[model samples]
Target: MTATRRAAILIGVFFLLTEIGAIAARLLYAPVLTIPGYVLGSGRDPLVYTGVLFEVLLVIAVVGTAVAAYPVLARHNRAVALAYVTARILEAAIITLGTLSLLTVLMLRQQPHAEPGALETVADALLALQDGTLLFGPGLALGIGSILLASLMYTSRLVPRGIAVLGLAGGAVITLSTVAVIFGLYGQFSAIGLVVALPVFVWEISLALWLIFKGFNTAALERMPRRSVDAAGAEVAS
Candidate 1:
């Protein structure tokens, strides 16, 4: 298999892994997020640790998906490719911050004697931080990054134009929803939020499967110059 095809497969695998990890983490953290002040004194639960682990894995997968596609994307337009990777990494870092906040809440809950009011206050603060990061990272950064990458794909014909359009439209919708969230027009994960975000979810999963199973269009790829790994480890195209 070609290196590009191998990278496409890797990206697809990690994209799915990211979704799985995110869902698992959400399931495990449901109690803490739903129950106010639950994080303050809720006895040590192994599930919290597991949730944090899944979140870390999600962060890794987020970055991995972007990096895997970077070389192929850079071949078309290096500037936008770099921007996309940077946006993804920034999103991952924000997610890591949210994960750390959750872990910290868990650590606080494990303490022997915690002041009830103080602990609750801290937990609330952390939770708020986590929510803010979720909106900023996944909603904004991810949306923008998807748009840039999808635009590149559309212009270069790396994937089907139809899929690219879906991505672009989905990205725009999510971004608009995020703005509404920031303005307090709707809650995250609300019916409206879900409705707005669903297209992007579909776009991403479809793109992942397509990349994994079909790879890029051969005619499209042929129109672009071929890139090879040189002895010095740089991509050199002739």
Candidate 2:
């Protein structure tokens, strides 16, 4: 297969892995939370630790998928590829820190026989960590990254304009919802965030399928206008 075909296949695999990872994390959330509660018999420590593990894996998968997309993006649009890559890397960092904060909360909860004051202190620390990392960091990074990727794809014509627009909208919703979550806004908005995320998920899956099964339309690329040559010259050049 050609280089473009190879890149397309890889892109498809990346998205498929990402989708699976998202589902896995969602499924694990309940189990992870129940573990701490089951162990402590009275507290929610097990649940917290399980959440930490879930978040960590989620971050890893997201980061990995983003990284995998870089080569394909480079082949499609070199000018915007670096920006997309950078945004994804930064987003990954934010998730990593957020996961660490969650882990910290879990560790604090693991104190087998602590005083009330100690437990209170730990709770306070956990709250602070959650606010700083989970509440703000990952949300902001992912939001901005998603927007950048959307814009890049749109401008580069790497994918359908409508899909790119959907991506941008989805990113905005996620970012705004994160802010709302932090500010203690209506609880229903959280569900709205998930609703907004659906379009993005669909677009990614469609892109993956197109790449893996259909590959790129080489004839279309060949027919596309070339800035370096006039129509007549371009035809001859080809």
Among the numbered candidates, top TM-score falls to: 1
Q: Report lDDT (CA) for all predictions.
A: 0.88, 0.61
Tell me how many clashing residue pairs each candidate has.
Answer: 0, 4
After superposition, the stretches of candidate 1 with alpha carbons farther than 4 Å from their true spots are: 227-237
Q: Write the per-residue lDDT of candidate 1 for residues 1-238, one digit (tens) a residue.
A: 9988899889888888888888899898877798777866657778878888999999999999889998888888888989999999999999999999988888888776878898889989999999988898889998998899899889999899999999999989898899999999989979999899888888889888999999888788788776688999987877
RMSD of each: 2.2, 6.6
Q: On a 0 to 100 scale, what is the lDDT of residue 66 in model 2?
A: 65
The TM-score values for the models, in the order shown, are: 0.93, 0.69
Write the residue-wise lDDT of candidate 2 on 94-201 in tens digits. Answer: 656755655555555567786657665665555456446544544566666677777766665666677678778877777787777767774522676567557667
